[model samples]
Target: MWNGDGTVEIDGFRVYYSEVECVRRIFERHPETAVNVRPKNQLVKNAYMNNLLDLIDIACLAPQELTEEELRDAENTLLDLVGVDFELDWLKKKLDELCVKKTKMETRGDCMRELDRMIVEQRQVLLALEVELKNEENEAVSDSARLGFEDVV
Candidate 1:
């Protein structure tokens, strides 16, 4: 028997069921879903995405003998579990917006690092100029002290 949750049990020979494998199985079952099939590293690293995939997968388990009421109930269960309105176009738009925001944040971080580097270099140049000015003042004072005057009172 298959639990429809990516786990099957029949003759005691079963495969390990994990969230990553569950997502892969969902893709295998519902080849028509238009969402991007993320890589294994992404599915394993993001808990929210994995659970969302699980919710999206619930529809693939439609029983072979579902009546109208059972089908409606199953649909409601999927909606309640995921909390998404399930509009394919709207979801795709949102995904694109998120990718744009991530890129902007990375660019801002790089700009901030460059600004910090410029500030440090300017401070070093100012320090060298101040040391040179101090040495010129000391030389002028020593030259004045060595000037000799006539031997008159």
Candidate 2:
């Protein structure tokens, strides 16, 4: 329940405002598990387990709602999980939405500005990934050439 201010008292324990907000998000995402509440200790354990499971899901299973920065940071791991072709396909799909769809749809003022910013960021990330791939390809070629000369000598 609610106890004045922004705090919530669940099972005789007072949780802070920020913690309640995080729990609210979790509950919103998992409404079925949110409904059944037993004791305080069990609720806490369940919440912890749910949070851990969510993290594992984000890292390994489904990567929904991942930001550009996160994808860039974990590019190798993601590529390993889903393959480079799949990653590129997904990125192209998102770029198409951000580039073509948004321009076609009419957005105004602040929303338009935010959308524009997002498009620019995504474009930059795509460019960087391309450059990185090219660099790696060049390095591999050079390394193979060096090994060939070593075998000759």
Candidate 3:
């Protein structure tokens, strides 16, 4: 029996709540249900799906703000859920990949900041050099004119 509110029931076993809440409640109430309800490796996938649904609810309720940690957790959950082969080794591999990707992204961001700083510094140096060159040219022209006047006299 479908409750039309993101919940369903079958033969008296009913999970009545939103997606995430229902799953969490069901897991809490019947730990064994985790094995029967979904593949062990896919647990993270189920959690991620629920979290995504919850995020939608959060967005509708409060669109103004969301914490970075919450967003990151959701992303991590999704990544963990993908390509699960129902094996412990596969699960560990997925986690490792996620960690590596996160580290690489952080490093790339740092490099970009350093590059920007270098560009700004270069621009300042170039401007200073241009000013110096202009001053030197002006001095040269003035000296040339003074020498010409002396020669004429």
TM-score of candidate 1 against the unseen true structure:
0.38
Q: Which is the leading candidate under lDDT?
A: 3
Q: What TM-score, computed on C-alpha atoms, does each candidate reach? A: 0.38, 0.26, 0.44
lDDT tens string, model 3, 1-153? 676756554323344454435556545654543243334333354454455345334433322244446546644554443333212233334444555555667788899999999999999999999999999999998887745566888
State the local distance difference test value for candidate 3: 0.52
Question: For model 3, what is the alpha-carbon lDDT of residue 149?
Answer: 69
lDDT of 1 at 28: 58
lDDT of 1 by residue, 22-74 (tens): 54554455443324433334333244344455444433343333344544554
User: lDDT tens string, model 2, 2-111?
Assistant: 86866676434355565766556544654443233333474554443344334334444233355555545444343332331121334334444543333444344568
When 2 and 3 are scored with TM-score, the better candidate is 3
Error of 3 at 134 (Å): 0.6
Give lDDT: candidate 2, residue 26: 43
- The alpha-carbon deviation from the true structure for residue 107 of candidate 1, after best TM-score superposition, in angstroms, is 1.4
For each candidate, C-alpha RMSD in Å?
A: 15.9, 22.0, 9.3
